[model samples]
Target chain A: MRIRRNLAGWMVIALVLVTMPALSAQSGKVTILGTWGGHELAAFEKVLEPFEAATGIDVQFTGTRDLPAVLTTRVAAGNPPDMAALPNPGQMLELAAGGHLVDLSQILDMDQLREDFAPVWLEMGSYDGKLVAIVLSADLKSLVWYNPKEFAARGYQVPTTWDELLALTEQIARDGHTAWSIGLESGAASGWPGTDWIEDIMLRTAGPEVYDQWVNHDIPWTHPAVRRAFEIFGEIARNPRYVYGGTTAVLSTNFGDAVNPLFTDPPRAFLHRQASFITSFITENNPGVVAGEDYDFFPLPAIDPQWGVPALGAADLIGVFRDTPETRALIRYLVTPGAQAIWVSELGKLSANRRVTPNAYPDELTRKMAQTLVEAEVFRFDGSDLMPPAVGSGAFWEGVLMYVGGEDLDTVLEFIEAAADDAYTSGAATD
Target chain B: MEREGASPLVHLVIILTCLVWILPTLGLLVSSVRPAHDVAATGWWTVLRNPFDLTQYTLQNYREVLGAAGMGRAFVNSLIITIPATLLTIGIAAFAAFAFAWFQFPGRDALFLVVVGLLVVPLQMTLIPILRLYSRLGLAGTFVGIWLAHVGYGLPFAIYLLRNFFGSLPADLFESAFIDGASPLTAFFRLALPLSVPALASLGIFQFLWVWNDLLVGLIYLGGSPSVAPLTVRLSTLVGSYGQSWHLLTAAAFVSMAVPMAVFFALQRYFVRGILAGAVKG
Candidate 1:
């Protein structure tokens, strides 16, 4: 009965096709599976038009946040998409570990990438000494976004050092305005923004080399540098005027949703120190404001020169499956200087291709950001992404909340250190 | 011997309990209608300050979400997957339940026990194998594939429910039919099945809601084909790699709830009867 129905369905399909135009000279399609949706959905679709026109290969895109999980299911079932773009390096590693990825070593031109994309990104996508993914846009996290008019009105200047950054917060607090708007509540993953704060602090206080050691577990979680990062973070979190609703509000507000009040009239708070992505949220809340006049970002200032905190960047890696001659051509087209140019001009995105000029960014601040990213001597990936997720996502977030709620620095550190040990012991790290 | 009126304390306690139970739902309702900025910055009660701020209460969210990412198609796909899964589960379970309750066969108890044993298998453990099977059969990423998967997973509890209702049917009725030389199928259709309406209706509503609200199975098997995805998948897509659009998310949440609420209310009269049927053996 099923076969008979299928036959009848085919006949219907044939009838429909007869009325429509027949296939052209080249019709083989490639499905680019990804999780970009909402505003980004429009951006990706716009970019795809030019690609399809150039290649004559039909490009079918399916967007969902659960794209990785869905792709896992599909690949396990032997019905994988032609290509998939996963945000985390760990996911690419997992796919390669499962032998689900097609090695791109022979095709992709790695030499053409940005000279300074924090080699850690390239390393993250490599497994068994083979490249599986290409780092796309990079996000520089060591930047603090602020209202330029508010700061100037308060006689505040952009802090050049960590001491100045701290002093400036106190100065802002003395003026009776809230110093920060720190919101980390992102349901089920409630404490990630707090984690980002800790990461920024670590990059500023501990230096990148120690940061790298902590990621590799060569330095224990209880190391002095790790402890100090928490101390500095807690100082701000505990100070009543530093954050509105302080500890409680930090726990209450959704991180993405938290940026809104800062952009409101009379401004709920003065500053938010998040990555470049927060611009989208700020843009959403304040409609007619331009970046340079209304808002801008300063590089996260250094506590001392030894801290190595000029910049920190994170990247989303794009990987391949079943690489063939056709797929090779596709990758070459995707990462070439020309393609990066299109991504910037059309999509308003930062491209990982170093050969492409940063001047292509539509906004002045983004172009400045691209220049700063290129000049940075040291860069680090998001520490949480490098750690085993069980500890990184679960324990780390929980630990940050505990610290914010006034748990002692040592106790919080010990709890996370033990959780990390359990994570490693359970074989979660090795895989 | 009756008191002239109930004690004020008792009345107050009942009102308080009702409020406590309804608090989260009320919060969600209020939060759903609120401006995304206000919801983010302050509590939902802020709306009470200037309740008539028509400017703040725009349907722009609803308009945007409905227009977002092929959600209209997802609604149709959800209905397509849910209706058949519900019907097929009820049909198969009814037949199986009738056999379990009325038929006599060697090892019938053991067979029923085996079916009950299946209830212990975690659905997650079986997901990979079942997915592989669907792909092998060319059923992966199809509407029929999801329906069959839902029905297969839904059957054990469904059979258990219907069998209890069938068992309570008066034994005299089946014997009377047997004496009249009516075949089992004819007796089932004419009498037993007709008497089992409440049970079937309740099961249908339950299975429909589960399949409709489901995200994991739909996502894994249906392939996010906008033409085939359900509300849950579409709602999740409103959130992107960077952040969420709460305006759209709130609207999407309300849209997904509308159909299920309608299904519940439409069947509510039968719902009460169905729930109480097996409790009274007559």
Candidate 2:
């Protein structure tokens, strides 16, 4: 009898403890989930401070590396957060198709948003003719980083066209130095850097229309356009004289550490093709090196003049699941120039908002990169992120590895095409 | 039993195996103390070129990891989750094992078979269903919910191991105790409990370490709420999503490993004996 009474008392206590949070969650609060942590999370929190002060709505943020799995489970359990910052549009499209996301066109001011954001940003964030997600920050990937000091000392000019780039590579090889340092290894995502190479080449050579068709699997993996992109990449990657330590080093070196050779004494490599974020790694490995002076970037030289200097990049998209008043208020605040300026200045990321001027960036190099992003004549999202996972992350990654490891290109293309056929067909059937 | 000494070749092989196992851990230890720039710029083995250069080492990584927001609270939360989960599983399994071993009850054999069968069910399979139930009960992010979940998942193996250990005890001891007019409760408390100390100690270590190192259960049930998250969850968030602040991971990993290493070393003597407890009849 005593033990039973004790258990009943504890049950009462547990009930009270569990109900407290639910009771306090009535109004004036919004919860968000995302994959940001460390300094990124801190910057996001700083951006939230003004909103919290003005609206008096409490914003609770949850950080996790496994956002997709957690978000799916939460949505399945009928308890999704008010908002979530998706890493890519692929997952957002999946959730929006399932009718789990709230259409932002109903909640946000469309005319104001259109004026602040570019058409490409809005188009990427829309699905089924309704805006469902919004992008706040972007990272430019079509860049070729080189040491300005070395280039000037060696009397080499920055290439502006594909022919000029080839001539520069040959000249550098003749000068008894490697032309490029390409590192494709990123742990399990090893060959993604190589995919970026192909995507950039595709945008330059075949134009954005074909790139979109290619990403959607409208064209088979064996198309001449795709093969041509691969062949162009091969000219630099397969030539022992053009790459730093031959194809073997390109296969083994980590993407983050690959740029260290460019900063070493008597610099082993001249040019590195990577995203704008590579500057962080360069400065980290070599302290006291100034950006824009010690190192600078030029656009990956145009392959076809018709396509012009196209931009290829990735961005973080924020989408809503529960449309409450506080959620509406917070979403409105997030896209404003006031909020975006703080976000970009603190984290050194490029804001997609046109109202956010270059002065919001921390350094001149970042301002230049932001300008490059905003001024591009043509811009497209990263191609691999748009395809089905079986081909994008699975076959495409492995195919690159096999191609670099000396497999025949024909066999590699066939392997990826087979996987794409299965993935896209089954993916459509499930939808 | 008497044992023969190993040959020189066996000794050499054992030494080589030990070296291979210890090399990575040694490198981690060395890297954890070095500055961030040095760690990224050169290999850990390079520090040995000037071994006495005390200026080459710093405790900044450890300081930063320990000082990161919510990490101290997370350490306490880990203890709060792990200790009770470990104790509850051991305590409940002990009584249940005693009942299955000595008590004459209806359907006892069938019940034991059912529990041993539960060991085959994967933990991942039950996460969503249990989470659904937990949400309905308003226990989704509560400490009590996680404790109950851990106990439920741990009970089957706990009972299997303890029942085997308790059954392997001599029947003469229980008979002698009952002959002396002792109740079943008294026999359980005074006889079976004392003799099963080694098995219990080993089981306690296993349960404690499993709960301490667990990430998925804590992540799913706790829902990334910083107030209830454990050390493993907090450590995972110390780096950026793309793993930008990876220089801090070596230190963060070492911090989480400290408690488990201490617990294992303290309770290691009974581990081997516990493994062999039920295998032999004599």
Candidate 3:
């Protein structure tokens, strides 16, 4: 009788402990952290609504730009949110390295992803060839946006090659308009626009093999190919008529504000080269100008046709934290075509899945943008973003400024190469 | 006649200085009231050009900031931390300064020297060891944790200033108080504190500002949860890779400033009096 009572008490205690998790975790709410503004948040809410209504999961969205800080602190405190939307690939890797992220391999199908993305983007979100982050959308940087009305009035044709581009720039100058409106100044990360210009030109001038070697740190920064790219950039940037504010414009003008003058009456600039995301800022500020009719884009002209202008883009990564059954469902939901359809329809975003047809783009420019994204044969994530912030937001941007501010190309390249080496090496040290 | 000629120039200089100082603040205030889209499209000063277009203005930014999770909680937390901190610091520093200035003891000058010397050590150098000590004491992430840390950090400057004012006190009054059989504590309360009001007021304002605007120490020791964080920590979250959300930022900044401004206005008379008293007494 005594033994049986003791056994019964132990069984009761074990059952209570086992059932406690079920009781505490009864509420099926999944929390997500993301940026506060734009169509992105609006879209996310729309996508999650159906899921929430179906499963009775209450979605608590924490809108914040500092997702990394919140995610890091919460994970350390052992109360991480279910999912987090990260803009930078490097941060996803950092979280993975710290043993904080859940292994998403079994949950996500990596083989079905678009093969056009730069290999580094693939590696940035992968640990030991196991996928950790699901890439949702991309922002392409190798397109030259221009006022179609102005181009038509001027009887201008889109340049097909580098020689034509330079000739066309001179022609546009003769036609009494700025050929390029380059603004790179973004404080702390001030020189990224210039870096994008360089990367775009390099893709047009230098082939993917050489680009890959440079990205992987195999090619020397002072290589002839690199020097040639800077010199070409300098020629256009330094030419007073080619850019609105000339070389100095790249330093003082805010990158977002650079496109403002281009939309002025008589068109301050005939050509403005920037990523697709800039369309929103442009169209928002300029009320009447239609995107597809008033303005159009052509891929940055090939310096040499063999190189093929590679698209410079960035991806938003969603990494899983806790591998509960619900978390797996969320991850699987995110990587699916249906999930992407909801994002595209609601968010006005470029989808990572080529199969999802984007219907709810904000404007004709974004419609063209959607088509361009789907048709892209090669896409590379922002190289600087792949680097640590100290380098990505620091020395890399500074090097671009130094070059624009009249530092010799060879010297800036050498410094950047050494800086990159030191940064990655030190990054290893911290880990 | 000589003073008359100088008055115009002095007024001109003062006006120019005020204009220069106030323009940016005015712009920030104006920007805070304008719609986010409008702010992005034009300069903040454009509103003054068309002040009657009230349709362009919006309280959406402030509404968003206030509605954010834990903002009210943070405001309450800041008050809880700052009020007691200011009072405790003034109370303790005033007492210590009175003793240091009036009493004669072994190492009297040397002890004063040591207290003053602490002012020179950089606060950053001591943060790590103190943080480690805090962890050992199980004080991290609690209100009491940050309060104690702030008290420790704020003491040297507080003690130094009060001691200077206390030292400047009229010794004859203290002697007279003693002769009347007033205890040291009674003499301090009756004679020292009353005369030292100017110093106390200035110190209170200075400490309040420091404790209010502080970010690093607060972030490190208190942890960056919305539940416990001050406005500075919340403001930092507005900055991310794309760029600062300037609309939200301006509103948040002004919201944080409202308290300090109110505190300053409420205490300005006392602050001015404190300075005047210090000058006269010294």
Candidate 4:
């Protein structure tokens, strides 16, 4: 009889243990998968602290560099997280098309989101006319970083037009210093910075309409507009006097280390074209460097006065995989200016929400960058990210390397065109 | 047999090879202690110029990785996954190898061929199907699930390796044991396993390191739940998505390397013998 009583006690404990996770999950918990870690992740946790305190909902964040692969596998295994932060719109669209993502318009307060964000962000985050993702942070790419002190000492004026920029480049070259430090190397993703150059130049030379057509492959790679952009980029990248260490150096230098030449005791290059995030790297590598004072940026000058300085940038978008009340609450909270201010201040990333004013940024340079993004005359997402992976990350990236490595322009264009043909056709067939 | 001494030229070549192999690890060790700015600013070899300046080094990277990155929990998870996975593979592989080597069973040769053939199957192809099955069985994201997956994936090579060693054993000892009224089980336990320590020890090290270093299997099965994540998974996430915070990766890499290095050194004697065991015959 005593043994029977003991067995009953053990059964109760076993039953409770088995049901514990389900019980906790039911109360208030949401799992978020993202590609952030270290400092960025810590900042995100801070962003969540207030929401967690107010609602008493537990937030679990899992960080992985391979988010797409992990998310795909989880979805296949029928165990996806409540939400996931997608690095690009491509994967978000793929997931949305698969009916794996919840329609954010249904869960989120659309009226508030419309007020918080610009229409461009909403449109970028939509698929099939339904809001599927919300961009959390953006990084401006069309900027030239130069040392303010060096520029002042050299009597170099920030160029605002393409002609003046060319004349300035000539003057800098004549001054016996390299005009630009263009680093094209990023392991396995080498040649991406080159792609950025082409994209930025494309926006300027061909205007936004043709740039869209180029990204969508409505126009062939051999089109005059595309070639013009590449040639304009080559004028700076290929010239031995224009780039620090010349073409070989441009191809060899790691993007992060490329800017080092500009910070040296005797600067090797006077200009570096990179995204806003380069500031963090600058401060990290060169200790005691102050933003705005030591270094500052101006928009990459207007090539066609009609187009103006269009912003080319990338953003991290969050999509809800499971539409629970907790997830809805979290999404609603994430869009608030208060939450966005904390995130931008902590991580030094620009917030997409227009309501997040410039003061939310930690420094004046970042404030200017945020303003540059918000007040741009025109804006477009990074062209490579919008293209199919086969052409975008694959052929387009390789073409940049080949072109800079002295491959003929015709051959490079044709090479990318062939891949785009195959990729776009198959991409359409699947859709 | 007396071995001739290596000539000076051969010695130089061997020394060069050792340097080439050790340089990267040496660089990693040096960089892990240096400040983040210093690491990014100059090559790790620059420290050799000012080796006496202790001010350049800091334990901040190590503290951040272990404390904030949650590598401390991951270190324990790696051990938990590796120890049981290694033992289970050895245990099961030893029994099967003994059966193939000694017992008279129908389809023994064909079954052995099938098990051996499994080695040619790539691990990636089975992840999805097995994961689907695991989720249905409520084993996904559990330590036991990963252990079983490791065992299953590890068994093909483990069994083949052990079978060859078991087959190479002197037949007289096993025959005499069986004739003295020893059961097949007794022979396996008392004779075969006892004689196969070198092979088993070597296999243990291989399995341990393989499971410890594995990221794909762990990521797929465990799904990066911090509670069950191994060191590899945690280490991969140490850097930002665009590979920022890479200085932390240097420290985290060494933290993960510490255990495998220790395991390899401890079983090193057996490892050398095990590699030579099947290669030579009297």
Candidate 5:
């Protein structure tokens, strides 16, 4: 009778233990909000799956392009997601300042991250002396794409300096082919390409300190350095002879579609300037053209050759909104090289983690770009993203369109300066 | 008689107007079938050049959209939302509308004046207030939260359309029923509802479409849980705002439109007859 009682007790213990995991799983789920979707979303899930399997932590991802607006609604309703992968450093800073973000230093060995990331990347992730975000993926924007086959067949070589680059562009024009394909149209954000041109030129001509000061509006929009940057952009953008269709086509064509002419028979245009992400569009449009063999990229040719290589890049920063064990674990896993290698290999993305080697990249061009990003002497976040939206997205974007449409440079500069004055002064009051 | 003399011109005008409306939808349909690369690289009109080349098209987009993991649950959520919201609006609007048409009471005109004025209060103005109220009442993220929201927003125009129809019905019908020992409740259930089907039917179509196509309200209240999201939300997440996969968007657009199109066709007789009934009375 004692043995029978023991058997029944054993059965009861088994019943409780078997059902325990199922019950606990319900409450342990962590929700993440991000803007990456489609193939990018698929890549992210693939990268994070191992962590989920290892820890039995269910991670739910929700994506939306308008992440900031959605996050505002959620936070106001007191139902913020457990973590959010923010698209820019400026937005991360805003959330950090609002007391909505949890400090990563409390839960993470942030000093260890110093070994993984470039110092500038880490600085961008911090707000008010607190590490609030860890960057996941980066896109390098200082690339100029060209048809290497056309270059080789014509006995041409890649330019190594700004002057040589200009001469090559003129030579291409002289050959009765268009030298550059430039498009600024992007629907509501129609003038962003113009901003990139100015930012890139500013980095080359004025150096990084002035570039930083200009972005912060520590220097005025009308300053000579800023004007010179605009003038250099105009030399290419405003000239009808250098551009593929005309100066007018620069304002009308969609940025992605601008590269299509480069792959046409005899190659309609020989050169295009865009971020590295344009590879997907180029390969998709021209199915037979192989990367590195048909098309290639080089960093924007140096102007002064003195201050160092200033590469403009963008990264998605993930911040913890709640100090939960699940979120902390996920953040830790994300920053590790093993997890980052999966993302880099799948999406052709760059990792801020130093241990994620260039060999993790999908192709030779991407591998080289990754190495360049890591080894660059100077790097800066996308300038428009760093400024307030009122000036950055509103007046600055609009000013580019006006300038491209033949509005005088001073008028556009004055227009943007007025907006910056209001945005910065109003921001100071809020602080 | 004059319309007969002008008939050919009228037909021409109608044909041109209809062409303007139908062309975009035709383009979307053509785009939905083209390959993802072609949709991005070329115009849909390019199909006209090589109409016989079936290799240029595929059903892959539709397969992806329908086979998406969340679609089945989202389809159910949409039904759960739209059906109840439509029924509730018709039921509540019918009662409020009937009372305004039949009853004699103090400040009746003022109350109705307020109800009509409420029609001008946009849905954007109400979303935040209702969200706060829903959270306080523990209705946030539940099916009932969005259902109540649609009903509230849908009521004003619903009552207005319905009240006018009920008011236009001959007064002698309700009176005869009342005199024959029918209570106002009895008259409402037996007499008023039967004759109001055409009006209610059209109103049902309107309410269903409004609730089905909604993204903002669903996103705000339902919290993107696959268990509670609708098709519009699911499809929207397939394409981010910064970049679009056009072939998927076009296919998803058709998939979401399919149900409303079916509902419209099914209820089209009542839709046309109701408009005629209202128009003939005037």
Candidate 6:
């Protein structure tokens, strides 16, 4: 019954995504499938408008997460959309390996792309040493959101180190206020925010190299570093004084709603850790609150301090399924600063291309986020998103939820380890 | 009326069952008017906390849904797909059922058994092959494509239902019609067709609703072409993969549900009689 409340919210989202069709009415057409909706889709249309005008190529955008499934079905039926923007690299690699994707290297100028994109950004879209997709948009996940005006009222200082963050939590509790407003409930994606926490903690506590090892399952889940990451999350998540409505609320509150308390009058809670997308949700839900005045974010503090600051985030990579002169022209335009400037300026999204000037981002905070991505010595993609779905989206998500639900840390890790072993060993990741 | 002593208990049970069935629909009706955030933050029951406050209500959701482009066309498209599919399935299946029921022929029982066996074949297993066939025949994304799919899928049960109903008719009626200088066709038209209205009505209702509500068949065959997609295909786009904005879904769902609810209520009596007809004999 409790879960149904959250499900109702998601059901509305699933039901309401039906929108306008971007049908191409002219010659030189490219059909692209993606999963964007509402504001995001509006912004994307703005991005494509300029490209369409410049190239005189009509781009038809069909939005759905059903891309892979639909693509598979259509391919079996001997039909597929021209290109698709995948949520992760796994599917891109799947299509590429299956020979369903056109190799970008053969048509586009790779040296130019390599010069424009960060090595990691380039790496995200590559499979079997060949570039299969191009990373277009990225969002930073390393920030912990809080209201700066409230921080000023409380005489709190931003913490750059892990010890100071812990002390601030104690100080907030001592002031008779909750320090954190943690909510992981997101319907089919309920435990994802919790997964982000574990990933961030892993990045901070065990360093990026070990984080990679853990994500790839080269190291077992029972390893000390992974366990320590989960335990460190427990310090805030498991503690009743640190969190707003206790552990049950963490399980019950929608992650979008998690930061709502931080915006209330006098502020009910002081902190929420979420990706860049949470900013829109914050402003959309509580219209009166100003970003820098009512809320601002600082990167999650360094755990070991010896490890340079880390940012965990995800990106959308586009892969072409049908090759044509028009499709090739679209791909070439996408990797440029001019094309991305239209999207970044409109949507407050950061570009993976280094060629895009910092000023292209809409706001001061976004400019700073793009700067953080540029300066960070260690950055990792969301760990769970990188692993096979059976473990990453599946067991790892459930593992974190179970741990937050007061299950034994060892038992939860062991459960995740069991899934990871099967998922990795069976080569589901490759598939 | 039959159980006089248990009437109070029966009434109590009936009331409870009605409450169970009606509450979700009531909640949906209440939610359709409330602001998206208000609906998300508080349960629909919270409106009853005051039950009198009208301050938070709005018709914004409905205005947006009805005013959207192609919604009117989508409603028209659903009718075009559904009406033909329903009528064709019923017309074709009625003949096949009549033949299986009245005529004595070679492998007649085996043929009836074969039709019965078709019910076990899942719709999903046949989709790809059917789509391939449709594509080769140049029928995909056409109204005929979806109509043919719905009819094919709706047939096994339709034939089974009509055959059972047809077999239950009296042997003497057909014999008397035959003795009176009636050909088999004349006998079928005169005796069988008019008497099977209840059965036909029920089958019509079932096939109509099934075809109307289907999303997979419409999406696959029609392939997002505006010229032929039904309401579900249009309504599905209201949601992106992330389920970003869902308030529209509640309104769209109610909009689509209205026609079917009307159809059901109009045809309910016949449907009940048809389902009950010859059920006891089996």
**Estimated TM-score for each candidate:** 0.90, 0.93, 0.79, 0.94, 0.92, 0.89
Give the Å error, residue A315, model 4. Answer: 1.1
Per-residue alpha-carbon lDDT of candidate 4 for residues A59-140, written as tens digits (9 for 90 to 100):
8888888777778878877878889987789878888989999998888789988988999999989999999999888989
- Candidate 5 TM-score over all chains jointly: 0.92
Clashes of 4: 0
Give the alpha carbon lDDT tens digit for every residue of A346-388 in model 5: 8777888888877899999899889878777888888998899
TM-score of 4: 0.94
Q: lDDT of model 5 at residue B262? A: 98
Q: What digit string (tens of lDDT, one per residue) describes model 6 on residues A130-177?
A: 888998888899889999988998899998888999999999999999
- Candidate 6 has a DockQ of 0.24
lDDT for residue B37 in candidate 6, whole number 0-100: 72
Preferred candidate (lDDT higher): 1 or 6: 6
Q: Candidate order by TM-score, highest to lowest?
A: 4, 2, 5, 1, 6, 3
lDDT of 2 at B151: 92
Q: Which parts of model 4 are misplaced by more than 4 Å?
A: A1-27, A426-431
Better of 1 and 6 by TM-score: 1
Per-residue C-alpha lDDT of model 1 across residues B1-282, encoded as one tens digit per residue: 768588999989999999999887777777777666666557777777887876666677777778775777778768777877887798789889999999999998998998888888777676677889988987776777787899988999888888889999999999999999999988878888889888888888888888888988887777665556678877777776765565577677778889888998888878988887567787
Q: Any idea what lDDT model 6 has? A: 0.82
RMSD of each: 4.5, 3.1, 9.1, 4.1, 7.6, 7.4
Each model's lDDT? 0.76, 0.87, 0.72, 0.87, 0.83, 0.82
Report how far residue A376 has shifted in candidate 2, in Å: 1.3
Q: What is every candidate's C-alpha DockQ against the true complex, given to 2 decimals?
A: 0.35, 0.46, 0.08, 0.44, 0.21, 0.24
Residue A207 deviation, candidate 1, in Å? 2.2
The 10-residue segment of model 3 chain A with minimum total lDDT is A422-431
